[model samples]
Target: MNIYKHTILLLFINFLGFKTFSYATFSIIAIDLHTNESGAALGTCYTKQFKIYTTKLNINLADYVVLENNGFGIMNLQSDINDFTPIWLSTAKGILAQDEPYYTAKVISKFLTQPNQDYKHKDRQILLLKKDKYNNITSEIYHGENVTNFKAGKIRLHIDDRFSIATAGNYMTNTHAPEIMEKAFIAAEGNLSDKLIAALNSIGLTNDLGDSRCRTSEGVSANYAFLRTFQNGKIKLDLNITTDEEEQEATSLLKEKYEFLQE
Candidate 1:
C-alpha cells in the first residue's frame, strides 16, 4: 500500500470506530499463474444491527480485509477486528521489503502474542498471502485458540505448482466450509474472478447460515460481500456488493453482479 492510500484507510478506520468483534466472515485468496492475477473474495454477516460506535457512519466491512501492493498480497483480519493497523503496516512493510511470507507472519505473530495488548491474540484469526514474481504463492493462516467453533483454514496448490489458494472462516455453521470453498475454486472454470466467486457461492451451499450468527435474520451466508483481482499492478476487477436489505443473501447479490461484469 502507498502512503496516500494508507492515510485514507487510517482515516476511514478511525471515522468508523472499526475496533469491534462484529465481523464474522469467510474469505479466499488466490493467484492465477496463467493470467498473473491475484485476488481475494470475502463475505460477512455484518449488517446495520452489527454496527457499534460507528452507527452513524457509513461503513463497508470489506475495508477491513487488507489488499496491498496491488494484489501482490492480501491479509484478512477477523475475530477481534481491533485496530491492528500496526500489524497490517508491518505486513505491508515486509512485502515491500521483499521478505518471505513466513518471516512476515512471524514478526506479526510476535506482536499478537504479546501480553497486555488491547485485545487478546487468542481471540484473533488472521490469514496472510503473498505471490512472488514466479507465481509461487505463499499462505499463512492463524486461528486463535479462543476463536469460535468451525474456525479453520485450508490451502490448496495447483498440480503444476504454478498457483495456490487459501481459504479461512470463523463462527461458521460447520467445519467443512473451508474445504467446500477450496473444492469449488478448483472445479470452477474461468479467470481468477470466476473461481473466487465460485468459492464464495459454495459458502451458501455448505450452509444457509454459513456464519451461524445470521440465524437471527434467517439470512444465508452473508449480508455484504466483495471480490477483487489485480494483474501486473493494475486492477482487473473489483466488485463489492451488499444485500438489497438486511436478512438477504449477499452471496446471491455478488453472483448477480459478477455475472453482469462478465457480460
Candidate 2:
C-alpha cells in the first residue's frame, strides 16, 4: 500500500485501543458551483473541559471537519468519537483520488459497521460533499441511529443552480434546526462565505442554545465554532474561535471575526 493508505491503517489500529468521547453539535458543508468555492462551518457545545484524551492526538472538534484544496470536497465527523483521524485522512485521500462522495461514504460506513469493532457506528454522524467529473456538486449525509436526539440533515441545491449545500445537527434544541439553516442559506444574499455565515447565524438567532446540551448551563449552543472556505486552490477564509467566558457564544464570536475581516 502507498504511504497514505498505510498511515490510515495504522491510525485505525490505534483507534481501537483509545477510548475517547467528544460531541460536535451541528455543521454544514457546501460548494459554490459557480465559483468552485467550497467550505464548512460548525458549532459545538464541546469545551476544553471535555478534551480528556489518553493519547497524544490533540484533535479538536474542528479537526473533524476536513477541507480539501481546489474546491474538491469536504468532510465532517461528529457525535461520538474515537480518534477519527484515520477516517478523516482516508476521506481526504479519497477526494484526492477522485472518488465520488457516495463511494467514499460507503467505504467509511462499511468500516465503521464492521462486526469486530467495539465502537458502535450508530453513534456517529458524518457528512461528505464533492464535485463530480461533470462538475455537478454532490453530497452524502449520514445520521447515525444512536446519535443524540433532535438530529436531522438536509441536502439542497440552490434554485438558481448556483450552489449545493448539506447541513446536519444533533442534540439540538429543536428538530427544525437543520431546516432553518437551509432556508437561511438559500435565501441569504451574498457570496458563498456570506451565505455560510448567515446559515450559522440563523441557527443562533432561532435558538442561541441550539445545542440543547449547553442550554441549561452556558445558554449558548457551543463554546467552539469555526468557518472555513476555499477557492481557486487557496484558502479564501478561515475562522476558528473559542470562548471560555460564561454565557459567551462561540458562533457569535465567529461572525464577529468574519465581519471584522470583511471591513
Candidate 3:
C-alpha cells in the first residue's frame, strides 16, 4: 500500500513538472487575400516538450479571430502576463487577448499611431495591420521602448491581389525573412503552402539562440495557418509546424489528409 501511495505521489510530482516554456526573438504572421486565411509563424530558442508547445499555439488561436480583414495586431511578450494594451488600442476595442511571441489577427484597417507618443521598451516589438472595407492595407511596425512611447519603422510593399506577410524578433532575419517569404509567395502565385516551403528553403540553416535566422535550435518555433472557406465559415489551423524538420515530416505524414497544406 505504501509503495502504491509513493507511486501516486511521484506521478503527481511529474505532472506538475511537465510545464512548457516557449520564447522567441522573431516570428512571422501573414494573411492571404484570395483565401481569406492567416498564418502566424514563429522562430525562437526556448525549450519545452512538444505537447506543451503545441498547446500554447492552439490557445493563442482561440483568443482572437484570424479571418477578419478589418484589422489585426501582433505583439511580443516577455512573460505570460495578460496584457492587451496594444491590441485594444490597435483594434479600437474590437478584440482583446494576451500577447504571444508570435501574434496575428485582422483587427482594424489602419496603423494605430499617436503623435508625440514616445513609447520605448527593450523587450517587445509591435506589428499592426489593417485592411479596410475598401481593401486598403496599412502596416505599422514599432519597437517598444517602454509603456508610452514606441519607435516606429516604415514598411515598404506594393501588395496587389497577392498574399501579405509580417515578421518580428531578433535582429536582421526578423525583417529579412518576411521580405524573402513575400517574394516567394508572389512567385508561387499566392500558394501559401508552397510559399511556406519556399520561404523555409530560402531561409537556409537556422541558428541557435542569440543568433538570428528563420530557424532556431535553442527556442521553439511554429508556423500556423488559419483558413476560412465559403462553405465552412472558419477552418482553423490549416498548416502548423514547430520546426523545419517537423514541417517536412508532418507534410509527408499528412500528405493524404491535408492536400491544402502541401507544396
Which candidate leads the pack in lDDT? 2
**In candidate 1, how many Å is residue 66 off?**
2.3
- List candidate 2 segments past 4 Å from native: 1-21, 48-60, 67-70, 85-88, 95-120
Relative to the true structure, candidate 1 reaches a TM of 0.80
**Can you write out model 2's per-residue Cα lDDT over 109-149, one digit (the tens) per residue?**
45445534325568778777766556756667777789988
Each model's lDDT:
0.68, 0.69, 0.37
- Over 41-157, each residue of candidate 1 has an lDDT whose tens digit, in order, gives 887766454443333444455555645565456666666665555555554545533534444444554544554543566877777766554445666788888888879889876
Best by TM-score: 1
**2 versus 3: better lDDT goes to:** 2
How many residue pairs of model 1 clash at the backbone? Answer: 0
- For each candidate in turn, the TM-score is 0.80, 0.79, 0.51
- What's the true lDDT of residue 170 in model 2? 88
TM-score of 2: 0.79
Per-residue lDDT of 48 in model 2:
41
lDDT order, best first, reads: 2, 1, 3
Off by over 4 Å in 1: 1-22, 50-58, 70-72, 87-93, 96-120, 159-161
Candidate with the larger TM-score of 1 and 2: 1
